[model samples]
Target: PAPTAAPPEFLLNAPGTWNLPMRTALASLPRSVWLLGLVSFFNDTAGELIYPILPLYLASVLMAGPRVLGLIEGIAEATGSLLKLASGIGADRMRRSKPWIVAGYAVAGLSRPLLALAASWPVVLVLRFADRIGKGLRSAPRDALLGASVPAHQRGLAYGLHRACDNAGSVVGPLLAAALLARQTPLDQIFWWASVGSVLAVLLTLLIKEEPAPPRPSAPRPDWRPGALPPAFRRYLVVLGVFTLGNASNMFLLLKAKDAGMADYQIPLLWAVVSLVAAVFAAPLSALSDRVGRRRLISLGWAVYALFYLLLGLAGEGWMMWALFGFYGLFMAATEGAEKALVADLLPREQLGTGFGWFHLVSGLSLLPASLLFGSLWEAWSPLAAFGSSAALALLALVLLRRWVGLPAQDGR
Candidate 1:
């Protein structure tokens, strides 16, 4: 059965029920939504623990520089983007999301243990590639499942809560890494621990009761055709591609933290702070999107990103970096879940996996050039040049979004 939409519970005259809307909304969510968030929480806890410190490991331990770091991240993201396109279509055609979801988690889980043995940057790059391939495999189907698990009004709530849960892991993961580093624990030990978290995510994934996929028409050729999707979705992808051209990996932001005179030991702690702030705000911002409108929220989030990028370039002190990073967290809260909800909003129920695949694909592919450009600019001129360029591109994307995304002045959602 389809998930039931919540009935309006607005009652201005009712005593002591000011929170009725929220309570009703919570009551309407499927159990799978919350369970899925927990699964992601564990999986991301594993991933973010490794994310915060990997750049430093590559630079400090493997004797690499900004260019190589950029190269590795760019390639890894590009590889995953390609696979997401394939996996999204596969989930739709196969009509079962759990097997692919399970396989993806298992692959990602087993790959992390190998990172403990990576003495060279090339080895690290390969492992990252493999790990992202696993991410690529699971992302679209997972999103489709989440959308299916809730009603339209509740999508932002579900996705937001999921982001909150996922970022909560990010918060803990970095702090965990910080604690381990402070104890003079070996890097290999941290990687091993990350594997433990990944395994937990896999186990939790097995507990999920996946909703069967809606059927699709048979086509001899692949279902990867972008033109065949909704016109609105296609247009949204266009603006998204332009915006993502400037949105590089958060590893650069971690690198920015280091450049702002944060101690090496403090980097993960700083990351923890960012994740903590994002976790706190993700649900509220996404819920606000449900009340107001997704397009407005998304545009605001992009503007926040632009402002943060510009501020990051100008930051000179540790305190300045701290403030800018907080804004970065706010941007993630405002956009991440809401963006996915907006995509699902724009497309039909049956087209969600494909739409989300295209969505992730455009965003993921843009990271390659974004990181490479930022890294080269850092190597050539200064951090100011790299970040200033990112700000400029982001502003342009914002203008395009405001002017051309074609959202109505008053949307019902």
Candidate 2:
């Protein structure tokens, strides 16, 4: 049976019932969505705890440089991106998403603890690679499960809530890292502590509910090739790819702050501020996209991204970097969920795993070039040159999106 598409009670006009209706609207979502949100929250908490300090650890402890960091992040994401396609196809074939989701989380969860023992950049690279393989394995099917668990009308809100939980963990993780650092915990200790959240995340996965996928032999096989997807999805991917090419790994942003004289302990706090703003705004902005339109919100988000990049290129002061990071968070809140919701809108349910696989694959594959190019440009010319080029690309993508993609007809839930 299809998930309920009944208009949410929040849309009702009854006076005095507003608060109750809002709660009811959220309560109506399938239990799986809520559990998955918690799962993402814990998983991201573990990941983000390790992420903010990674650049510092690599630079100060492991004696690696910026270019090496770029390679590691780029290769890690690309590795995961490649696996997303295979995992998505496998999910459809096995007629189950839970096993993939559990396996992916477990793999990633297991990999983080090993980072504590990493003594060289190459070792870190290999561990990060393994971690991302787990990410790639789960991402598409996880997204497809979220989409399948909701009705058409609620997709945006569902994804928005999920991102909010994910971002909230981002906020908590960094603050926790900062607190731990203040207490004089060694970086390795922090990495070891991160495994706690990873374990909880994997455990939470055991309770999630998934509707059975179509039987393997009877499942509709959408061609995995990009050319075979709906034309609108292809065009959407084109614009997305263009925008993504400019979006380098965020480690560069923390590096920017570090270069501007921020303390090592302060980097996590700065990262937390960014995630705090993103967590606060993600749901409202995404729900707004549901009412207004995904394209309009996405266009505006890209525009904000361009401006943030442009200013970030010029920021020379720590205060300026702090302010600009908050702006960057706003950019994330606007697009992260809306982008996925748009994908769900453009493709049929049967093909969702493949569609999302393509989505991650494009973004992931692009990160290699994007990060490498940005790092190269920063080293060869100046940070201004690299960031300015990214801004220009974002603006160009925004224009193409507005001109080429129109409102897509909504497919049924």
Candidate 3:
């Protein structure tokens, strides 16, 4: 027998809900949404434990410089971006996602231990590559799983909750790192603890159950035909790619804080502040997108990001750094989940993994050039010049997108 109609509670419409359309949308969210959120919470907490402090560790502990930082980040991100496409294809071909998901997480988890053993900058590079390879393999499949699990109406909320939990981990991980640093814990020890956290994330993945893959069409579809994507999706991707080109790695931001004369101990606190703010706003802004439409929120996010980069470049003091970082967190809250939700809206159910893979590939690939350009500009001119160039690019992208693509309709499915 067909599954029974969802209970009234699950029907999305309920009395006194503030936004009836959004409420109806929320009602359709799947249990997998929250479960995946938990998985991200743990995984990102582990990832964040090392992420915020990585550049600092390279410079202070390993005695590397900006050029090396650029190379390492550029290579890692570029590799991961290519892998996103490969993994997506693999998932589609295998007709299985969970196994790849599990393998990816396991590889990432294992890579953390190697970080604990790194003896030189080159060793750190290898470990970072390994970790990112795991990220590259898993991100598309995991996102596809989330997209598959949720109803069309609630994609934003589902993606938002996932970002919230991921950002919440960002909050906790930095705090934990700060505490560990304060205790004079060795950097290797911190990596070891992060490895343990990754293990927990892998364990949680066991609990997640994906929906069966959709059956393929019997007739062969034409390859690369015109109107391949719904007009809305293609427009959205173009806009998103433009926005990402200017959104370089957070390492630059951290390095900026350090350049402002903030002590080593203070860096993690600043990151914690950013992550905390992101955690608070991610869900609400995502929920808001369910009402106001994701395009508007995304445009707003790009505008905010542009402003923050400009401020970071100009700000000369610690307090200004703190303020900018907080606002930066808000920018992340506005964009990350909304971006994922937009991708879900654009693609068909059967092609979710491929769509997400392509999405990750586009965004992730940009990081290489973004990071290299930022670093080279810093080395050649000044940090201000580097940041100013990125901000200008972002503004231009935002303008072009607004003029050309415009916003998608928000009918809540």
Candidate 4:
């Protein structure tokens, strides 16, 4: 008997089935989504080219230690987070997201070339701050735009695809750096070459057209305080704050890799492996959230984080470290997109920018204390204490999330 073909309508409408065909999933998105994804890809490429090397550079070249690394990342992210809150408000008032997006990318792009000239830790800190300032200005508005471009149902897939592109660039950037380093290229020269990707990313942003915001009656200005947001949204932010406290900068992980006997040139290769896994899995996992529910996927990702952090504390050999790093990418791929999509689900259309702003602010503000605490633990006790403590905190946060946060009304699951 010949098998009957399923109806096209069935494939298109079925829950959890949209992401099964990668090409079909992509074809369903708008042009703006693709453009924004490409923009992120190039932007991340430029950033990651320097990122994986930065800890090593500071440690070896400038003789900075782990605590200094924590301080720099904490300050940079905190500054960017503050600006993100401000920019989200500004984007809402101006009702023109593209300008903010362009300016932010341009600022960060312009700052990349200056790194080649950085001779001191303070100089690097200043440059890093400037780069984050650009990120702060653009992130919320850009996410708001992406959320607007896709339909309510497709938000997860859109964000997931965007993250996938970003991670893909992360993979490429390190591979490029590794190739150059293998040929004995100077770090400064690599930094100079990175500027090309930044330039290209900025140029691509010029072509992205914003979706026209729906018309609305003029009304009283809304409150900016976190208390004014819906109860569900506010509670979600609280859970995120809890989770982020356990989430220190990945630089610490790289530092751990080095301490575990991974060589300097091999560092970028290891970084690439993590990014490749993220790039491959990010979209599919995020798409699954669109069907299963964001909370479930996010919770699962945190569970994975807790598990790995515990194992990482026990890992000693180079192969064990590499395996841990590779699987750790799963945590990133699962959470990043689903988290944003959940934000979109929680907020009204007009408030998306501000909502995302507050979201980033909460995450960013907690990061300083998180990194400092992690670094302090490492310095005071041992790597085991640092990683183990993070794992415990992650589990606590997971419990809070499950008990306090209810599923959003729109989440069919």
Candidate 5:
């Protein structure tokens, strides 16, 4: 185990937290973290190819509507959320996450081809549910494993690079999808290629070498269960959960662009740019978080989100819509890895999986209602109502965060 600054309360023989390593290059990263980043790159590339186009697919191919899109995304996200918690509990008991990690990549990869055969919304839902089952199984364990590999002080960079690679693939996948769509390639053929990235992700995941897990504590486990997370993490969750209440699925962003007069094929290109911006900024912002503060970076991202969403609600120009898409990407770049690193900072090494699981659960479950509400509002009221309400909620979340969430000054470790 890496050296520690201090152990947490009530855990003897437990490893102390790790210190910052001298980070110099890609070579400075732990081999496992780098490999995992590659795995996320391919896996997310596969996912983004389908995801950016999926709303269009449902609308054009299956004759589904906006509510259908919202329902599918909400259900799929909820499935991942609940399973994340269950898989965390299981991973804690088993003490090795590699098998779950491998299985997740494999299942998600293998399921992509099945989507090609779907004839209706329900079929897509079933396949998506299966795919998210894989995502749920892998997410918490993968995060815990990644968090375990790096020092707490440097975690932002490690996970930031991972998200960068992940969104980098998102950039490539959508551009590729756009190019293919421009040439009039069939959607079914695109789904076939999706499996390639995921398969490579599975193979790459096999290359990562995990440290042997520390033994579980022998004393009777806390009766509060996941409630046993440190006080800081618990408090942070309140703000995180509320913010997620407005973090509707990204599909809505595309739906908004479409409403703003963008063509179906153009959506992929827009998404490619959004992802390109996210990929460009992810590493830099995350590295900055290590220097300044994670909470501040995250709050700034939400502030940007609030501004963008407010503009989205009232904007009249296509160019502004495009600009908002890029800003949306910037928001993701700012928050994605910083939030996970913040969670790691707040918890002990042993409970990292459970901590991430709870984060995923709360965030995703909140998304279900948020999406449902957004879609309902869009249908019953106007796009303005939906986007305006979202902007308001995001602002509310930022206020709550300032009131409740605490960030101690960094030690320059």
Candidate 6:
């Protein structure tokens, strides 16, 4: 007997009809996203604990100054950018993401303990490089895994929830470090504790189930050259690259907070506030992109960032710094997840790893110069000059992006 298709009324009315089964299925979809979010939460908690303190450690403890900071960061980020591109291709060739993900975490986890033992600036430099290498290796594959695990309709939500969880960890990590520091815990001890959290993050990666590859209709052909992506994707990457050139390391932002009369202790608290705001808004704003459009949200986020940079440059008091930092979180919430979701929409499933790799590579590679430029401007001129210039570039990028790419409509899910 021939199988009967579903009735036209059932198919057509699916969105309007409040079916319990459909609702349950929709509810279940965000699960994998949330789980991955938990993993990111733990991982970022570990990262933030040390990341916020590293510059102080270098400047005061190791007697290194802004020059060393710029050199180390530039080298580490450049290495990471290249590795991100390579790891993407490797992940696609190996057809396994978990190993790369696990290895990356393990490497970073082990390096944190070494940071505890560093007695000199060079040692710290070496350890930072290792940590960033792990980051470079894992980032693309992990993102690819996350994208593959969820339905296309929910990519924004998935990436947003992940970013939110990651930022939530960022919020908690600094708070924990602050408490520990207040209790007179040694910096070395803090690094050791962060190492424990990193280990736990690596363990969690073991629990994520990779989706099986779809069976090929014929034997897979070897294609050493992965072709170019869609024109929209290429254009989007260019705009992102431009934006990243102005988006230097957050270390500069911390330095600005200090310069703006924030006490040493207050810096961490300000960062915590930023993280909390980002965590709270990330998921909702990302989900909003699904209904409206990613380009609009991303462009708005960039504009907000320009405003924050200007505010940071001009801020004179602690309260003003805090306000700008809080607003900075909103910028991240609007942009980060929506950017990735847009990439997923533009690229084919098989090319995801490469696409993400290139996306990250272009963005990450810009960081080295951006950081150097910001640091040099701060040293040679005023903090206001440095930040104002960055703000101007961001505003320019925003204008160009809007002109070059109109707001994209939601992809038909």
lDDT of 6: 0.78
Model 2 agreement with the true structure over 79-189: per-residue lDDT tens digits: 899999888777765657888899999999888878889999999999999999999989999998998888777877789889989999999999999999899899998
Please, what are the lDDT tens digits per residue for candidate 6 over residues 256-371? Answer: 77767766666677889889988888876776676666777788999999999998888878778777888999998889898898888787667778778888898888888888
- Model 5 Cα lDDT, one tens digit per residue, 151-252: 765687788888889989998889888887888988878888899898899999888888998666685542226568877678888888778878788898
Q: After superposition, how far is residue 261 of candidate 5 from its true place, in Å?
A: 1.4
lDDT of 5 at 114: 85
In angstroms, give how far residue 312 of model 5 lies from its true place.
1.5
- How big is the positional error of residue 396 in model 5, measured in Å on the Cα after superposition? 1.5
Total clashing pairs in model 6: 0
Give the winner by TM-score: 2 or 6. 2
Question: Against the unseen true structure, what C-alpha lDDT does each candidate score?
Answer: 0.81, 0.86, 0.77, 0.86, 0.81, 0.78
Which window of ten consecutive residues has the lowest lDDT sum in model 1? Answer: 9-18
Per-residue C-alpha lDDT of model 3 across residues 130-190, encoded as one tens digit per residue: 8889988888888888877766546667787788899899988888888998999988888
Q: Write the per-residue lDDT of candidate 4 for residues 1-413, one digit (tens) a residue.
A: 11224312213233223444656767888898898899999998988888888988899889999899999999999999999988887887777789989999999998887988999999999999999999999999999888888776778889989998999999999988888888988888888878888998889999998867766678756456787777889988999999889888889999998898988888888988888888888877887787778988888999999999989888887778778888898888888999999998888777888899999999899989999999999999999999998898888888877788766765744
TM-score of each: 0.93, 0.94, 0.90, 0.94, 0.92, 0.90
What are the root-mean-square deviations of the candidates from the true structure over C-alphas?
3.2, 3.0, 4.1, 4.7, 5.8, 5.1
- The clash count for each model shown is 0, 0, 1, 0, 0, 0
Clashing pairs in 5: none
**Can you write out model 1's per-residue Cα lDDT over 218-336, one digit (the tens) per residue?**
74433569878877678889888888878877888888888778887788888888888778878767777776789888889999999999888888888777777877898899899
How far residue 230's Cα lies from its native spot in candidate 1, in Å, is 1.1
Better of 1 and 6 by TM-score: 1
